[model samples]
Target: MGKTTGTRRGAWAAIRRLAASDRAAGLIMLGFALIGLVAANLPLTYHLFETIAETHIGIPYTNIDLPIGHWAQDGLLTIFFLTVGLELKQELTTGSLSNPKAAAVPMLCAVGGMLAPPILFMLVIALFSRFGPGEMGSLILTTTGSSIPFGEMAHGWAVPTATDIAFSLAVLALFARGLPGSIRAFLMTLATVDDLLAIILIAVFFSSVNAWYWFIGIAVCAGVWAYLVQLKRVPWAVVAVVGVLAWVMMFEAGIHPTLAGVLVGLSTPAREIHGETTPRAERYASKLQPFSALLALPIFALFATGVHFEELTPALMLSPLVIALIVALVVGKPLGIITTAWLSTHLGGLKMAKGLRVRDMIPTACACGIGFTVSFLIASLAYTNAELSAEARFGVLVGSLISALVSGILLSWQSKRFADATTDATR
Candidate 1:
């Protein structure tokens, strides 16, 4: 019994360590993604995998019958978003983002990164439309025997605008090891802002809120949550109940239920208001991050990225949407981030953190293109057709891979240069 207990303790310790590292999370998610893709494509496993993913679990007397894939996207993904909200709260209230001057560059970068992709995506389509009747024209024709409307295609413009915070930070952890913590801080702040913008876009454009009055209930629940959090003796169970009720209310309102996580996170006091053992943000993040990083994200990746190989034809690869996505993610993300950051430094008189250089920021900007999770979510929201959604996901995967590879190479060179300079100084 003692031996078994020791083994269990060791296993738990290892899991905790894995959860704590961004690199581990990234690698784990990447592995699961690969597994999903393989399972999706292999002749022997494809049918089984597709069946499982497509299986719908119905809730009796309710209209909540959704497939497993939808559950992963709408339900499981909320945990990851909750952690993101906590991080955002911490940064805005007390962390690096607290100082407006210090965060100016990243703030600009975030805005640029969000705006550029959709514009570029639409432009690519517009240019292709000028062709009138050609490869681009045929490509826009959906499987439904109808040509995709400009508005329908444009709805997907926001798909590539997101930056996958977990994956990008993981790459940074691996390649920029021993670098200044400020670099991580800069990336974190930028990605958090990028995500916040994505959330706003979803709420504004993607949502179809049928019953706006449900928001009144949501507001009430949120207010109650905030009140309980402010009390000297906090009732966490009550907070959890209220949070769920708020989520349900939002869901009923036709708004994305995940935003409730952000609401609760934003409602939490970032600092220690009641003289607690730890700050609310830190405590919640600690409690939740492990679940988000280790399980929620990887499972989502597995469910979301299972693209079949038959869809990867050369003509389809060269289609306008595919081209737009690749360009938006690979080119637009870094260009937008870097250009805006540079302009901010000049106009806002922003100063880089000590031990950080302009060149270092470039690769990190490149890394911003690694848009995976939220991008997938946007793709689903944008495209109802399975074929179009699959194409979008494929483009995201390819673009994110290119971004990661390019950023890794540049970061390695930067890391080497920094090491050489440090060694020379020591000499």
Candidate 2:
């Protein structure tokens, strides 16, 4: 009996140790991201960055190969969306977003948040772009130009919208042991609202020139989704087939193919099964999650962010494209999130976790600025023009990295201070 208890305790301790290790590795990856940012901007690293940027990998059976980056976003990241969809389903079933009443404030804030950013960005462009070459002093937008010719301000619409959850949670993990649970919940709540808004913007605003055939394909994809919901003995393979078809259909439909993920995911059922083992739809999402998180996301991040900076030029760094991304994510996300949440909490009577205060919000809001994966994806969808995509992708790297770092710093400092205060008051 003594031996068994000792072994059991040892095993439990081992599990806890591993969990800690994973949390550490996550931060280290952020470190790698910082180094990557430095490498991307280095004058001597240009060749390496270009080589990595241009490298391709794809489905082996066909002649179809995309750069490592594209494979990550479109191919691998689809799995990420699958997981997101699954999470959304679970939320709809029993989680925070389960009911309309509970969801009202976050949903409304998310929509307003999305709309406000683009409108704000467009106004920024309308005002700044009129000034002509070298205008706005240093505040020029890097994402500019959508036939709108706002310099980099053209891409500004994309900047304020992204919130990187993995990075935010990483910030919380640094001292999550001592922090109030409500704060983490609040961050997740806000970011999830932010995500729904981001998805809508991508689907509606960023759509390509209409293709009727693609629209039909989308209909077929919708049918497949319906089948997934209706079929009594839905198989994982069927879900996979439908998911692939959804991607192809979205791509053909002149819609952003990644939105296919949201479609497929939303279509998946979260129904509890009776007199059986795993349910078909939930099983598929569960199996897909590991692949998406461990393999797909990391590979995507490495390739997408792995640029060498040998080509770094002061001119490029100061370009409107780069600066616009910085402004959108860095300046825009925090302001948009905080202002919206404040209004929602005060005016809309939205409830947050207890012990949460607006002042405690700044760090979490800053953390939301760490928009890595989706931000990079949106930068691609923002403009189909190749050179524009590359420039925007580079800008994503810069803005996201800077945002993650600063957010981490702010969150860490705030977490410590809050913990100390809580301990003092308790005493």
Candidate 3:
């Protein structure tokens, strides 16, 4: 019994370490994205890359039929989203979001971050429509010569609205290491709300279920999940099985299956149970965040970030769709984050997190624009045409690059300033 308990402790320790190394995941994602970019452009490797991304993987007995890329997107990505849901649940129950006064600023900032990007996207499209020739039509809006309708392109607006929490947190871990703990909490809360909003957008706007019964089935599953989580001692394995079943049902219902992650994660108890020492949210995160950060995200990046440079000409690069995404991500994200956060603190009477000023927010807010994983997903969902998808992917890559660079410089500068001030005060 002693030996068994020691082994269990060792395993949990390893899992905790893995869960903590999100910075490593970010670095690995960056390296793989660079490799994907290189492989996509190299003629010798391009065929292999496409094959790997497009290969079909399914259980024929169960009638599961999707490309390997789709599996990574729809199935494995749920693990990552589940971790996200766990974090959100923890915050809402016991962390930064538990306090209404403290939560107000970041929550408002998240709302701003979501609201500003799409409006800018539409406004930019409108500007192009007004001034440019009919050839430069917006991706979602109807232009003089466009074949795509307004409804389709409108879906793409949510692409920039999402803040890739993985990448954003990675940046915070890397450059803002010296900042106050509350700043990290603030950003996490903001990103959580941002993700919650994105998930809602996917459900309301993107769902295309064929029958009402499918939703009824999902609702029943969710009700059971909620009820089970409230119990003192419940079978987690059974919950896992039910979660998978619900995912399949959601997929069949034409809703994005990853919402399964959100549902399960949210249903988990963030507080400690009667018999357990650890909270369910933390327990679930320790077991799952490692798989999510180390495997799921990297694989998704490998499949999604491979953009062939040869296919992108000057015309395609400068197309209204591409340009609009770039501008929205790089400009609109920071603008929305800052504007709304400022309003919350100054006008709405919410206090800023300790040791953080409005000045400190600029760099972090800019980092919020790194809408990598979900942005690419939304882009694909928004446009079925390969050309449009490729262009949007390229735009996301460029915009994230720009956001990373600018935020990196600014964060480094801010850190230096804070350090120097501390030194002076000590003297």
Per-residue accuracy of model 1 over 1-427 as CA lDDT, tens digit each: 9999999999987887889888999999888887887799889999999999999986566677789988888888888888888888888898877887878778878999988888888888787665545454533553233466556667689999999998899899889875678888889889988989999988888888877788899999989988998888889899888987887787778888788888888888888875587788878898787789888888888888886757444676676677889999989998898878777766767877776655669989999999998998889888986767887887888889899999988888888887888889999
TM-score of each: 0.92, 0.78, 0.89
Off by over 4 Å in 3: 1-19, 61-63, 131-154, 227-237, 307-316
The lDDT per prediction is 0.83, 0.65, 0.80
Higher-lDDT candidate among 1 and 3? 1
Q: Which of the two, 2 or 3, has more lDDT? A: 3
Worst 10 residues of 1 by lDDT: 137-146
Off by over 4 Å in 2: 1-68, 103-105, 112-131, 134-148, 151-156, 209-213, 225-234, 275-286, 306-310, 313-316, 384-388
Model 3 CA lDDT for position 297: 84
Residue 48 CA displacement from its true place in model 2, Å: 6.7
Q: How many pairs of residues in model 2 come into backbone collision?
A: 21
**TM-score (C-alpha, index-matched) for candidate 3:** 0.89
**What are the per-residue Cα lDDT tens digits for candidate 2 across 1-427?**
9999999989866644543343554554455555555665666775686677679776556445678666667777777777677667666776677776755555554554455555555665565555544534434333233233454437546755767666667767764556787777667666676777677777777777466876777777767876766566766587677778778767656677777777777776676655546544566666665465556666667655655433456666665556666666666767776777688888878865567766677776666767777777777667655555656667766776677678777777877887899889999
Q: Whole-model lDDT for model 2 versus the true structure?
A: 0.65
lDDT of 3 by residue, 10-31 (tens): 9978766865775777777777
